[model samples]
Target: MGTATHDGAESTAGDEELVVSANARFFRALGDPTRIAIIQLLLARPHTVSELINELDVPQSRVSNHLACLRWCRFVETERKGRQVLYSISDPRIRDLLHLATRMAGDNLEHLAASQRTGPDWL
Candidate 1:
């Protein structure tokens, strides 16, 4: 009985560790604006690293770094076609999250603008 209880506790701890690790990786990957942009672009279609560099208009190194982080987080995947590597979002849920975030941002911006126009105390 003691051994069974110990094993169950260990199993629970392992499951919690896995969940926390996954959550940490996801938030860490999303902590960058550039990375978020990359994910958004990839949500549309796969692209080579060079295409990402051009589209995001950022430094090549920065784009590459973000791509690496995203891949580690399991939010994106890579494929090889000839000498070129393509990157794309691995899950459709990421695209949905991006869309939701965009909508929320837009609503927040509009609310801010309205508040400014009416003054903060204007109820």
Candidate 2:
């Protein structure tokens, strides 16, 4: 029936909108410099909170807070090694995502810098 087809189309459209919104949120999570740095470190290997603090030269609280955010986003996973909690990238594809993003940013650095609509100072 026409009504059934219309309902199905509406449902599909709604699903697509949800997907787009989720994708945007995912990127927003990576928009933070600290979160991005956390991911970059995890890509190499797992690290403990203390190690991250030492490597990043940030306070323990700052490292822990960002680690929590990364965990909530499912961007990284954790493991227990004796008394230490080690964090690592949740998926291999994340490495590819970071690599591609880096290349894209490099290619568009000029445009991104010139854009007044959005940038580090936009907010």
Candidate 3:
């Protein structure tokens, strides 16, 4: 067993801090609606920046910015094909994770929706 620190982390210096920072960066990277849309689009297939702009209907610069963020998070990868740079999902596991999250959200939303629809029997 390792020594415990006062902060409930291992005595190993910087390990916990690094983990916290990485987790924050990951969540922050995916926090934006635009970034999530970019991920969903890339999950379907690789697309050039022009293609993405057309499909997403967002401004070119905004899409590019979100693509950069996704790339930094390692969720997106790019290739220089001809004159256009194509972006695709870097990890297939991300698609699986997204699917699982969608199911989980739907499960939760079903309860919320039923509650909202019926409301309180007393009311």
Candidate 4:
């Protein structure tokens, strides 16, 4: 009975490790700029890889690479239609994050411009 209990504890530990590793990978995938752009574009609507390539104005290889990362992270989902895959954000939290990022960017830009007008030396 003790041996069985020990094995169960070890199994639980292993499951936790897997969960943490998966979470780490997900955040690491989101750290890329191209991946963030791809996610933001997808928030509007689903699009084929070719559409993303044109919209992002990036190379096909780069877009495809980022899409793969997003898919792995489970932040985006893909649907198969013949040879093409349509991609879109799978999580609503991503849309909230995008809005928050936009607001932060606008606020930062305004602060930067205001500081520049006042001159850094004056402060």
Please tell me which predicted candidate would have the highest TM-score against the true structure: 2
Q: Where does candidate 3 clash, by residue pair? A: none
Tens digits of per-residue lDDT, candidate 4, 1-123, equal 212334465345666678699887766677566898898889889999999999999999999888887887788899999998899889989888768767877858666545544443553
Query: Clashing residue pairs in candidate 4, if any?
Result: none
Would you give me the overall lDDT of model 3? 0.81
Error of 1 at 93 (Å): 1.1
TM-score of each: 0.69, 0.79, 0.75, 0.64
Q: 2 or 4: which has the higher TM-score?
A: 2
Model 1 residue 112 distance off true place after TM-score fit, in angstroms: 10
* lDDT of model 3, residue 44: 86
RMSD of each: 8.3, 4.2, 7.5, 9.2
lDDT of each residue in 78-101, candidate 1, tens digit only: 999999999998988987887776
Candidate 3's TM-score reads 0.75
- Please give the distance, in angstroms, between residue 35's alpha carbon in candidate 3 and its true position after superposition: 1.0
Between prediction 1 and prediction 2, which has the larger lDDT? 2
Candidate 2 lDDT score relative to the true structure? 0.83
Instruction: Provide the lDDT at 64 for model 3.
Output: 86
- Rank the candidate models, highest TM-score first: 2, 3, 1, 4
Q: After superposition, how far is residue 20 of candidate 3 from its true place, in Å?
A: 1.7
Candidate 3 per-residue C-alpha lDDT over 13-108 given as tens digits, one digit per residue, 9 for 90 to 100: 577677789998886787566787888888888988898889889999999889888888899999998888999999999888878867877858
